[model samples]
Target: MSEPKRKNRENRQHGDRAAALNLFPLPPETEARLVIYADLLHKWQKTINLVAASTLPQLWTRHFADSLQVQAAMPAARIWADLGAGAGFPGLVTAIRLADVPGVEVHLIESDQRKCAFLREVSRETLAPAIVHQGRIEDILPELAAPIEAVSARALAPVPILLGYAENLLDKGAVGLFLKGEHLADELTDSAALGTFARYEFSSIPSVTSVSARLLVVKARAG
Candidate 1:
């Protein structure tokens, strides 16, 4: 294809994606919170790399909206648990967006103390009403005070480890909402070796310009 044609085609594809996706329109408060989140991340990143420095420009599409997609998926009715909730992507965003939904709660789980501190501050600054856990999946899942309605992860770990770590919560009726990139098919094949599940749905993240932005939702049926 000619260069101009290719450029136009790319622009059209981007436009289509923007239209088909329910991307979050920036609310004044949400926008402010995102600014705060960015500031904190930059300050911390001087010592600890939270997200790839190259990804800063795409932060809104790749991080916030990507995670925020979860809120719209469920109609703001379910309890959510975000595993390896590093830098608080969907978990913090979900908490912020789902704030007014009665009985909605989001749990942000992380093992690193520094990241835990970040998550807590995110909740504080965003008034996200999210619970931050500073421990491993094994350390906290079994002791959860109540069953969770939803569980999710993003760039957390491979599907196999995610499935293993979240097994307990999954057994307690939690549904999975995980974000995966281009290699999703390969990861799913690897995870299938573990066992069987009741349902699995894969949807591309329309809000992301990043190629292969897909979210996987899995349900673990009671055995």
Candidate 2:
């Protein structure tokens, strides 16, 4: 590679490292799998538009790290359902991390057929053990047979609406781990008015970009 290109790659790698500084170190095998996942994402991006065009340069920190942090928060959760799992942020990332673990499964629920096709291909190529559920979250949650230990969604919807979509799973004892932005306070206020059956614990995301973002862990119960 030319000097300028090499320097740019090095800078990108450094940025990825800096953004992931707060996450627990992954085992070598898991790290290798994530590398494969990232490469596949880039290759598919040319045709599918898996993520926002602007975020492509910071794929590792912005997308991968943002997703991996959720697994760090809920380490004990083995079975997860990722709603609106577009491009498979936390869901596919979680599956890649837990690929070798016994009984680990991540169900990726995406409504868009094209996105679902991309997700399925990625899962198969990476051997990530993710089951792609191609349908609306409202239609699929009730039909899930496995007992979901935790649920996750990123950049999906407001807390109240997300809770409503995950209501069935939440009522069945699945905890929600959602990624939200600066509007958390407003979301909480709106969710209160909606009489949601879930409670949330908010914490700052260990990210280099957008300090306003947070990790919302929702504990839900039957009302």
Best by TM-score: 2
Best by lDDT: 2
Model 2 alpha-carbon drift over 4 Å, by segment? 1-3, 14-22, 197-209, 221-223
Tens-digit lDDT track for model 2 on 1-223? Answer: 9999999987987777555644547777877777777788888889888899888777777887788888888889999999999999989999988899899989999999988998888888788989999998988988889999999999999988888888777777788888888887788877454555334333444443458888888775335
Cα lDDT tens digits, model 1, 1-223, are: 9999989866764554354234567566766766677667768878877788876545666677777777666664468888888888778878877765678778888899988888788678777779999999778877778568888888888877787888777766777888887777787777465463333333444435356667777776545
Summing lDDT over every window of 10 consecutive residues in candidate 1, give the lowest-scoring window.
196-205
Minimum summed lDDT over a 10-residue window in model 2 is located at 197-206
Kindly state the number of residue pairs that clash in model 2: 0
The CA lDDT of each predicted structure is 0.73, 0.82
